[model samples]
Target: MLSIERTLLRLVMAALLIGAVSVSGTVYFATLEEFNEALDAELKHVATSLARYRDLSDASSAQRPAGTGRVAEPELEDSEIETFTRDAAGKLLYASDEKVRMPFIDSEGLTRVSVGGESWIVYTARHRVGYAQAAQRVDSRRAIARESATRILPPMLLLAMGIGGLLIYGLRLGLRPLDAAARDVAGRSARSLAPIDCTRLPAEITPMVQAINGLMARLDDSMTAQRRFLADAAHELRSPITALRLQLQLLDRSSDGAANAAARADLQQGVDRAQRLVEQLLQVARTEPEAQIAPMLPLDLGSIVREVVEAASAKAEAWQLDLGATLAEEVPVLGDRSQLLILLNNLVENALRHTPSGGVIDVGAEMRDGRPVLFVLDTGPGIPKAERERVFDRFYRGGQPARSGRAALGSGLGLAIVKAIAGQHGAVVELLDRVGEPGLEVRVSFPRR
Candidate 1:
């Protein structure tokens, strides 16, 4: 994995190094040019001094008059600067070295030439009678330039090193909050899901921190609900299992045929009830918000209602109630097929269990106000408006027995499971009174796509 810290440090270091090298190189070249100019000026001064006399000897040893306070002109040294003079017609009149004479340039300021296998700086000038020239060794002038330019390095190097050290330290200090956030996350256990401290955190990191906090908050809620569901499920299962065991014992101990037949019948009923409860519990778990479910697909609400009513027709008949469906022509919505089916089944099953024999039950799908709605209505005394919301709570058996005898899931898991499934599908479940009838209408409204 690529690390943010190392990449930042390397980029900054590279920029500093480049900047330092650029400054040092510019100073070196600028100093060298100035030094060369000073040396060339000195050469011009010497060449003009030679133009005053015909040859080098009188110009050097000639003394100023005895009473004059001024000193005699200084003699030119041949090793440092060679002097020469020529007439206008190119006849050599005075030569510092007679054997190796340098030819003059057509126009003069400064020029380099070869003399006796060494490079020389030769300056030439026009004189009243003839032109004079002076020369100096090129190697000598460059030696001075090199020494002066090199002095710039030590201070520049020290400054670069100091700046580099400061950069590394500043980077470490500036990035400390990100490291602290990582450690905070690493140190947390399942129970400790508090948000990370955002004080003094950089703006670039804020969005990522907020996202993590949101996920942890959701996880905390899921874990809490799961713990509660497990506790309630365990409590609900214990009574039925205990009753089944006692019924089995009663069947084993009964001596008369009539008593034995009654015990068997009661035991069968208890087993069937336990099976339904386990089924409902599984449905609730599958509909949990954290579940990894199949993607929801576009489906027809009418088609789903028809399927559920058809499947429950036999169950409804056995309970001595009328079961029917009324569906719109095109009630399309987005939903997970299996979960929506589970939602409808729970509502219908509870209705069948609670409604008196000969009562009416209707399932239907239709569009109202631009949303798909499914409804299950029973012609039995409906849940009071006050207790409608409470029925969605897990294992919420009513304070009094329902219309028929008791709730199918004790009317507990059935409605709770229905609510959980509807929430996952972004649907809402409502309990309303049937118009003019002493019954309940359980309506599930699905959002438009």
Candidate 2:
């Protein structure tokens, strides 16, 4: 591909060359026409002046007689000009050059004739006594026109060269910003997604720069989210793996059957915890902002709430907690059923894990102000207002200790997944202290259709 500067220079030079040629050709033809006209007029005037001397036959060759209708001949400094006179019988009377003789023709204003192997233009004027003719060589007339046309060449060439130089310089100057931008991008490390500076960019290139910057910003955000996810996964996986290792060691050391069985149970619990952690991590990944969510369909929020409550009731009973649901009409919302199921499961599981035994955990849905709102209310010790926002961060357990006091077996990704899924459905999730109660209420509000 050609460089922009070279291409622009080529185009400009071509235009200038064409223009110069056109102007030169036009001027050459126009000058030739005007020169021919002037030559013809001079020839006619000379012939007319000579014809005024009607009695040329009576005059001596030395001088014209006084008052004999004689006209003083103009001195011919140019050797190319020749004049001659002829009588009625076509006999030559006098000639400007002794060797020069005018060509004979029946009648003529101007005519071309061959004289001594050279082309000449002659003009003839008839008088009462004789005819006079004035002639000039065609070669001399052509030389004058050629000289006038050649004079235009030097200035035109200089002008074209000067303009070409200016054009090249202007192109380089105009493209400097783009060159700077390319260099800036090339010099960056692969990890760098920083925006290219547009402070001094030209207006024509500003949109392209802005588009590049926008892509850089999105890539930076995606990379950041990926890094955070990996770190959180590593941190969250370490504890359960360590616990599983310890349980295996205990099982190996146990000699008695009771001790072996206890170790086996502990091992199974550790495995289960690790498995749950892995599942939550996967859920968090699936719900990432960059991930494509499952397609949405119109779903009944109330039915979804009831289904979650029914599924978790057995687990709630095992923990001696009351799991129930309140359906305040068939709350309709548009969402991916499986993702909403995951969202609801996380909310209820979080409530069950945090709430103490015999605590009441209620899942419900309702339509409020033309929008569907789903909520989970737990009778557990609520999170502090200061820690509410941080709880939505991946692997971030709130500052408040778990109500059960035994090490909580919950992965901290629950609320993060909840938040992500809510956002995917164009819903807002908020954690607040249950009104007039010492518990937490998590609410998801969906946009109205």
Candidate 3:
């Protein structure tokens, strides 16, 4: 379908043509009318003059020739009038010898006359003298005027046609830029996010060009971010996998029972590290937009934190470390319950792993600024101020373990998982010092959606 602007232009041009044709037709018809009126008047004047000549000849009893010379000494007529006469009742009384063989005068005031073997209109009128009438030729006058008009019509029609064609051509030429712009956009591929070249465009299209450029820049940024994330994830996963393979090869040698048992334990530890890395990778992938995770619903943040604390306490007991929790009554937030639980579990477990056998781990929640604020505080070596932000990155482990006497085996992705889950739930994670002491405190806040 044509757009409204094109359709409107078409209608306007059509109306212009109609107006032009109508005006031309009216002027043409009016010219013909004026010619007829003048012809009629001239015919009446000729008839009146002829009638006066006839009355003079009748009263003098002398035959006066229609085209007689100035000398009046003749006793006989030389040339007779080439005219026709009719009575008041329109009965033909006489006609010239040239028209004798043809019809003379008609009662309807319309009749043909033959003069020198050519046709003419013999228009008649009654004279004031008794019973006598006169007529004159009106044909030659009307024919000349009509012939002049016929000669002028063709050029005027040609001019109108030329003007209309030029208008259509000019309109199409003016819209060429718009057509070119459309083709430029449609020819691009889905992965092509380059800016368009609009250096020669008209001023009206400047805004459109700017808009397309802005969108392209944003798409390029998103693509670059995704590429960086993939590269980092691959680097993190590769180290553990390579170590596990080497450990497995050593376990294959069973030279001595004690040596074999030690090798087996080392191999099992390597396998465990690899498994944890893979799980964290999957969790990060799931948090992405393309993962198709369902929308979050209202869930109790406090209860979820308590559950993670209880689980971490069991692990702490096995390691001879103390685990404790101080959850507020009910800290409700809008989020996926399972994802929130996963986040809580990772944070508590991370604290327990870094703390020594005699160190303490505490989990708690409180309401702050109408938001649910959950924190995991541990009596372990805290992150340095310069490296605190870097710790949230995937596979980033702190330089020193919080436990003074021992080290914890970790794949270094637990805090990374906590950050991802918090981000998905529209929350923020912050690192702080626990009560201005030597321990680290991780605080997560989920907005009340």
Candidate 4:
């Protein structure tokens, strides 16, 4: 239930903080390593200078052994003398300051030395009077670098906080459109299905807005269809229901045998009509989006077609219309059995209702293009090319044929229910030509999964 902006801002801030912490840790470590290398190189250079001086001084003293006592040589600079010393076998000799300890490595025999604090290398060699050594303090540099790096983090953290706050603020502003869109959706009614505007939205949310808008459009169509069906259903049932009540009253009040019989017959007809209308209404309601579907089972399309043909046979006989199934072998399909039956019954009933007396109605189901195709074809006045699409719309009946004989008794929801059923099953239903005659052919194709 969090607002879009707050949620987005919080997420972004968390990510930034994590990244900053990680980068800071990496930089601190890398800086420590670089400082250690630089310090080691500097220490080695200073040590090398001292070693060269020691070699020169020692050589001079050796060449003038007699003059060493007679002629006094100027004292060498403190920087050019050894702070510590080792013998020929590399044992510790002496120290100048407490800070000057034995070289990290043994300072005798080998040309290079390595050794402590974290280990460092020292270089040493033989001279005429004494041996000289060059030492490298790699660990001292590492310690200083680590300390400086640790010290730098607090300021970096403050800067990152400021930058992160600014970025989160900008992100919230950039995402304002999504917030507005969410509010727009929240404020809408259960019946409202209008599309949201996306022209002024940010690019990041444009596609989401567009998708919602498209869904809204479809919902609008569905709602419109539902409302229309309800209105038409009410209209269709009202008259018959009223007639049935009036006929029942007359039958109850009647004294004569002939009058009572007539009233009873009228009441029965009205009741039948009302019942049919109610059943059709229920079917239409099942097509609504909120309607739940039962689990699908393997049902044969041919069996459904045959059952519909058989159920319509009596009505077909009354109209003097021939109704029979021309199905091949069982055409297996995965669907809800009762729903499929209702679909086929509606289609076949619709065909028989429209076809003229002596007209032949062919109900068939077969496999075509690796899909199950169920069709109902009848020889009657066919729908025009312009009105074929309109006929599938709920409560839409063509001008010429809708009011013909008992066809006028229909609730006009039959074709719409058929279309809905086909759509639910991921099938396609289309009206086509009945061979060479002037009649309608309704073909429903259900693709294999």
Best by the TM-score measure: 4
Residue-level lDDT of model 1, residues 323-438, one tens digit each, is 99987679998889988888898888888888889999999999999989999999987887788888789999777665565454362788888888888888899999999878
lDDT of 1 at 38: 69
Off by over 4 Å in 3: 1-194, 197-215, 398-408
Tens-digit per-residue lDDT, 1-449, candidate 3: 76744675678667766666665565556765775566545455555555555566653332334233322221112112235444445444444443343343434343556655665555554464422222334444445545655565565566666766776676677667767877877887657877788787777776887798787787778677578777877887687778777877777866899988988988887777778777877777777654677687877877887778776666789888788888767888888888888888888767777776788888888888888988888888778999998888766787754444224456567787888788888899999987867889999988865
Q: Which residue pairs of candidate 3 clash?
A: 381-402
Which 10-residue window in model 3 sums to the lowest lDDT? 71-80
- Give the Å error, residue 120, model 3: 42
lDDT of 4 by residue, 151-172 (tens): 7677767776787789778877
Q: By TM-score, is 1 or 2 better?
A: 1
TM-score to native of every candidate shown:
0.70, 0.63, 0.58, 0.79
Please provide, for model 2 over 1-449, each residue's C-alpha lDDT reduced to its tens digit, 9 standing for 90 to 100: 76878887988899998888778878888987898898889888888877776555444552333223334578456426787777676676667766655576548589999988989999988877667888888888777777877899778978999999999888888899998998887887659878988988999888988998898888888888898889878887888999999999999999999999999999998898899999998888788776886778998998888789888888889999989998877898899998999999999998988888879998999988998999999999888888888989888887766658433788888899999999999999999888888899999999998
lDDT of 4 at 121: 47
Instruction: Arrange candidates, best TM-score first.
Output: 4, 1, 2, 3
Compared with the true structure, model 3 gives a TM-score of 0.58
Ordered list by lDDT, greatest first: 2, 1, 4, 3
* lDDT, candidate 1, at 425: 83
